[model samples]
Target: MECLTSFCETHLQPHQIAPALKRHKLINPVKNLEDRMCKKHKKPLELFCRTEQMCVCQVCTVTDHKGHHTVPLKKEFGEKKAELGRTKNQMQQMIQKCLQKVKEIKHSAELSNRDAEREREESEQVFTTLVRSMQRSQAEVSKMIGEKQKATMRQAESLIKELEQEITELQRRCSELDQLSHTKDHLHLLQSSPSLCPPTSTKDWPDVSITQNESKWNVQKDISQLDKKVRRALSELEEKLNNVLEKSKGDDLKRMQQYAVDVTMDPDTAHPLIIVSGNGKLVRTGHLEQNHFYNLKRFRSRVAVLAKEGFSSGRFYYEVQVKGKTGWNVGVAKESINRKIGGLYPEQGFWTVWLSFQVDYEACTDPHTPLSLKSKPEKLGVFVDYEEGQVSFYDVDTRSHIFSFTGCTFTEKLYPYLNPFDDYDGSNSAPMIITPVNQTP
Candidate 1:
C-alpha cells in the first residue's frame, strides 16, 4: 500500500499539480511572480509607510547592500508612486500647453495668410490700373503722332500739285512761243518774195493784211505782259518757298520773330548821370543841382513798361546809367508807371539805383530844389542788398560787384530815377551805365 500510495502520489501529482506548476512557471508567468515577490519583499513597515521614512527589504539588504543605509519599502514605494503621479500630471499639462501653442500658431498663420492674400489682391488691382492708364496715354500719343503725320502728308501733296501746275503752265507757254516763231518765219518768206503775188483776192487783201498785223501786235504785247507777270509771281513764290524751307530746317525759325532796338548813345552823353534812355538819348538825368525828373519824349514807343505793353513778349536787352550823388536818393524804379509823367515806376515794376561814396558829400534835391555848389563832395559808389530789396548794383559790364544797399524803396509807377548828388558831377557826369542782360548780337 505504501508503494501504491507513493506511486499514486508521484504520478497523479505530477500529472495534475505538476502541470499546473509548469504552466505557472512559463517565462511571463514567472516574471510576474518574481515581480510580486520583489514587491512583497520590498514592502515597508506600517509606521515607515505612514511616516514616509526610510525602510528597505531583505532583497535590498542582502549581498553588497547588507548593513547599508536604506529607506523603508513602503516609504520608497509611496515616494516613487507620488513622483510617478506628479510626472503623469506634468505630462498631461505639457500636452495641454502644446495643444494651446499649436492652436495659437495655426490662428496666426491663418491671419497672416489672409493679410497676404489681401495685399496681393490690392497690388494686382494697382498694377491693372497702371497698365490701363499707360495704355490710354500710349493711345493718345499714337493718335497725336498719326495726326501730325497726316498733316505733313497733306502739305507735301499740296506742294507737289502746285509744282505740277507750274510745270504745265511753263510747257504751255513754250508751245505758244514755238507756234509764233514758225508763223513769223512763213511771213518773212512771203514778204521777201513779193513778186509772187500768190492767190491775191482783190476783194480785201489790204484789209486782211492790216487786220492780221494788228492782231499779231496785240498778241505780242499780251505775251510780253503775261511773261512779266509770270516772272514776278515766280520770284515772289520762290522767295516764300525758300523761307519756308529754311524755317523747317531748325530752331532758327525763332530768330525771325525777334525785334531789335538799335540804341546809339551820343559819345558825350554816354555818362553815368543818365539813368534811362530811349533811342540812345537820355530820358532820365541825374544832375548835381537838379531834383529827379524824367523826359517823357525820350520814352520809345517800343519801350517795355508795365502800364504799356509789358516787357516785350520776346527776349530783349537795354542799358541805362545811374549817377551817384551825396544825400540824393536815386535808383531804378520797376513795375509801376508815372501816369502824370508818362512813364512806369516801381508800382509798375521800376527799381531804384543807389550808390555809395567813400567821402562825405552834399545831397541834391529835385530839379525844383537844386543843391548848392558850396557843399563839398567825395568819391561815390553803388550798393545793392537783396534782403532789403530785389535791386542789385553791378558794374557797367555787370561782371564785377559794385555795392549793395538795404532798406531802400523805389517808386513803382514812375520810370527809374537817378540823383546826380549820388555821384554825377560835371567832371564825372557819367557814373553808371546799364545794358540789357543777354542781348542778341
Candidate 2:
C-alpha cells in the first residue's frame, strides 16, 4: 500500500511541476497590454501627406519625417473636395460662355441670311421692273414702225399699179394702129379696080383725099397734144412721189414745231402833214400824236415766209397797237407788179401787209408810183423796221412806237406812207417805235 501511494504521488506531482514550469516561462500579459496601449495613445505620423500625395504609417513618419508638419486624412480629403468644387465651378462657367458664343454665332448667321435674302429680292424686283418697262417701250416703237412700213408699202403698190395701167393702154393703142394699117391696104386695092372709075368721081376722089389729109393732120396734132399732157402728168407724179419717198426716209416730219404771230397797222392823227406827188397831186396828211391815235389792219401769213427774209428764223411772238385818223385799205398783196405800173416789185412772193388808197393811177415802169390819196385823208403813214433780225411793218396811230408785225412777208409790198401834217404846217410825221423779241434793254 505504501509503494502504490508513492507511485501515484510521483506521476501526478510530476504533471503538476510541468504546469508550474510552463507558467514560470510565459511572458507577462500586463506588459503586452501596456505596449498595445502605448501604440494606441502615441502621436500620429507627423508627415506632409498632402505635399507628398501619399499617406504614411506612424512608424514611417517617426523614422523618415522629423520636425515636419503632418495632416490628417480627413483634412486632406476636405482640401481635395474644396479644390474639386472650385474646378467644377470654373468648368461650368466655361461651358456657359461657350454656349453663349455659339448662340451669338447662330443669331448672327440668321441675320446675315435675312439681309442677303432681302438684297436678292430687291435686285430681282428692280430687274423685273426694268425688263417690263423696256418691253413696253419696245412694243410701242415696234407698232409705230409697223404702221409706217405698211403705209409706205401701200403707196408703192399704188404707184406700180398706175404704171402697169399706163403700159396696158399703150399696148392697146399699138394694136389698134396695126389693124388700121391693114384696112387701109385693102381699101387701096379696091379703089384701083376700073369698075369703080368715073370722070366726075375722079374730082370727088381728089376732094376726098384732101379731106382725109386734113383729118390725118388733125389726128397727129391731137396725138402730140396728148403726148405732151401725159408727159407733164408723169413728171408731176414723179416729183410728188419723190417728195413722199424723201419725207419717209427723213426725220424732218417728226421734228417740226409751229410758231405764229399777228400784225396790225394804224395811222397817226395828232400830227397833220401833207405830201405832193410827182404829178402835182396832193396826198392827204395829218398831225399824229405819239402812241395815241392810229389806224388798224390785219394780215395773215406763214412762219416760213417770214424766215426767208425776216430776222428771227426760229419761232417768235409779237403784238401791235395802231391809231389812225383816216380810213385806209389794209390787205396782203402778192409780190407781182403790173408792167403798166412803174413799180418794180420783188420776186414772186406774198406780202401779208398792204395798204392801198385811191390814187391817180397811171401805169408806169417807175419803181415808185404815186396813187391819189382820196377820202379826206388827214394823215397817211407807214413804219417799218427789223429787230432781232425780224422785219416788221407798223402803222402809227399815235406818235408812240406801240406796234408789232405778226404777219409774214414773202415779198416787200407797198410800204405805208404817212403824212404827219399837211402843207399848212410843213411838219414831219410822228416818230415810230420798234422793239425786238426776247430783248429786255
Best by lDDT: 1
How do the residues 94-205 of candidate 1 rate in per-residue lDDT, one tens digit apiece? 9999999789668756755765566566556545655565566556555655655566667667666766776686677666555555675776656645333333232452
lDDT of 2 by residue, 1-441 (tens): 111122345555553477653342222223223322224324332233544566554565556554456676568778889999999999999999999978966875675576556656655654565556556655655565565556666766766676577668667766655555567577664665443332221123222222334445655565566557555655665665555444332211111101223332232211212222323222334444124333322111110111111322333233221123222322223323331223222232222222222223211212423433222322212223322222232222212221133343433333222221222333322222211222111
Q: Over 4 Å off in model 2, which ranges?
A: 1-48, 65-69, 182-441
Tell me how many clashing residue pairs each candidate has.
69, 59
The alpha-carbon deviation from the true structure for residue 241 of candidate 2, after best TM-score superposition, in angstroms, is 51
**202: Cα error in model 2, Å:** 48
